[model samples]
Target: MRGLGRVLDRREEIEEIIESEHKRVLPKLAEYREKLKGKTAYITAGAAHGHAIIALLKELGIEVQGAAIFHHDPVYDNGDINSDVLSSTVKNYGDVKHYNVCNKQAYELVNILNRLKPDILIARHGGMVIWGAKLGIPTFLMEDEQFGFGYQGILNYAEKVLETFDNIEFTLNLAKHSTMPYTDLILGSSWESSLAKEIKADLLILSVPITYRLVLTCGYVGYNGGLRVAEDIYDRVLDTYR
Candidate 1:
């Protein structure tokens, strides 16, 4: 019982740190609100920040027409984001369509974008960004520089690896002994190469330990809050184009 209690306490502490870092990036969203007015935009974001950013954009007078929300999970299910709040939030924006971008086919997204005909696209993950670019739409990406316990969505890979191996000790043993690179081992060769293509991320939000440091490297600007900053950057692009 004592050991369980200790583990729970540590988990709470980590959650607190993540939550705090998430809030810290929110202020930057305010900087570009006004610049977003009048543009019709589509956004892809996770539950936590995605819903909030949508509300903020509405307040700023931007016409957000479609969104693919990666819902904040209620339970730990490797990469499966719950769309509970996200669906409702999109409805609040009056006819704004919401899509579940979690593990869905790319063509579905392309079809949605074609129907929405947004002036710009804002996304929180690599896949959406690539889809947006393929359609010749100006794309903006906003995502934490890393995710899920201070890694590049590593938990997702860990979960998939666990599924593949089907045993805890064996999974760990394979990870320890496998000659394959960790990224390749976890994400597989197909995803590895595709992830490489997604590397030219547009707007990266610094997360955890160095949450406040904003760096704009790789031709992609870095900001504090995840998708909120992406929305801001997308708004500015809208301002320039329209």
Candidate 2:
């Protein structure tokens, strides 16, 4: 069957990627492990993305202080019970703090961050960065879920964490003087008519916007997408600090 052939081909491709990425990423992670020694992190993202990043960080010797998933699904469409994100994460990483909350709950997230007080915060959605900024914790904003897909993805994640820590002073300075509203800003909405007027955060339009902006080419789904997202975030951080 053509479908079966395509599935087999995909499996082979993924196998090759994993093998190649392991060779490429392991040495880099060894270096990163030393640079990240004793640092703790808290992650807040969607189920799959959060799980992958947590796994990669654990491998790199970063302490995962806690994690918050936006939602949880007991089983996925494939009908495999073992594929559940929550169970798999716990099984793999062991008893790190976990929370299930929606993306809009800024108050609760802030409370949790205050309680955990991790050295860094890693997040994937809009508005989450501001809480870490407000709390004076350096935050790395993952543009999408594919950020931890392959070995390069793992390297990219490590690089971003190091960059976040490298620029901690800037984040602390911003927090000291930031007057941005404590509530979540509704991107591409009339509520936040002018994002510049509301906050000084970098804006990257990644989704179907309700505003006049149109996205025809840029995507964040696969291998190339992961690279693009990493580049965009890194460039933004450089632009901010330099």
Candidate 3:
């Protein structure tokens, strides 16, 4: 597990990456309706990921009630639920939800969660774990690169010169997040396990970004790639906390 110090050391760089981040979370789009239909979630913090998730949920049939955005400005697309942007440094998405909590503190965040009590809470930031735990909501932790990759990279180079890139795609990878079950993260990556012994949730949704990355990069092959990733995540989470 990477420590707080390690994570902090790369904080600025990570923030940049996460701010520019693009993660592929397609869950076998065919079953998307089945997986997300009738389900609801609260996407807190980080607009890009939140927007991505909002799209994902909508595709899957789940309703994205709203987001507790932590970027530059609150983007308002829906008339009802508003988004929260913490500071100017954090970037917001174009789909723009509403805005409200501008200068408020913990009360605003928890107050919103207390009101929503969403079925699932998806947070992409690697730093803030206490807030998620405090919300006492079933959380999904998204890790950037904790999972293993390289099952298909040919790394072909002529005279160390970069040649055309051809990545081998996996139809599915059942072992994507095998170690998650042993950790404390909801999406149980090492991110949430700093003082893991101090806090353990009844359930965790630990996700692996590596396998799914390949899936999306592979396009049509992503359908199978995503489902297999989910299966792997689900099985590991079940084994650890279920």
* lDDT against the true structure, each candidate: 0.52, 0.73, 0.44
Report the error of model 2 at residue 61, Å.
Answer: 1.5
Candidate 2 lDDT over residue span 58-176, tens digit each:
87889998888777675763668976766676787776765555644777788788778999998888788889988799987887677666567777778878877876888898887
**Who wins the TM-score comparison?**
2
What's model 2's TM-score?
0.63
How does each model score on TM-score? 0.38, 0.63, 0.36
As a TM-score, model 3 comes out at 0.36
TM-score, prediction 1: 0.38
Residue 70 Cα positional deviation in candidate 1, in Å, after optimal superposition: 3.0
Which should have the higher lDDT, number 1 or number 2?
2
Q: How do the residues 1-242 of candidate 1 rate in per-residue lDDT, one tens digit apiece?
A: 33454777776667666677557533433433444446677778776566655654464456778677665563343444453445555567555555454634576677787677776676777766766555555565657534322322333323332243243353334434433111111112332434533432222233333343454542334454545656655653454342
All candidates: CA RMSD (Å): 22.9, 19.4, 23.2
How would the candidate models be sorted by lDDT, starting from the highest? 2, 1, 3
Position 8, candidate 2: lDDT: 77
lDDT, residue 143, model 3: 47
lDDT of 3 by residue, 1-242 (tens): 12443667876666555444323222233443554457666666555445555554444455666676565334554432344322321243234243332312555656666577666656656544334455455455554322211211111111011111121111012223122222333554444444343544433323443332233333223778678656756665576554
Scored by lDDT, model 3 comes in at: 0.44
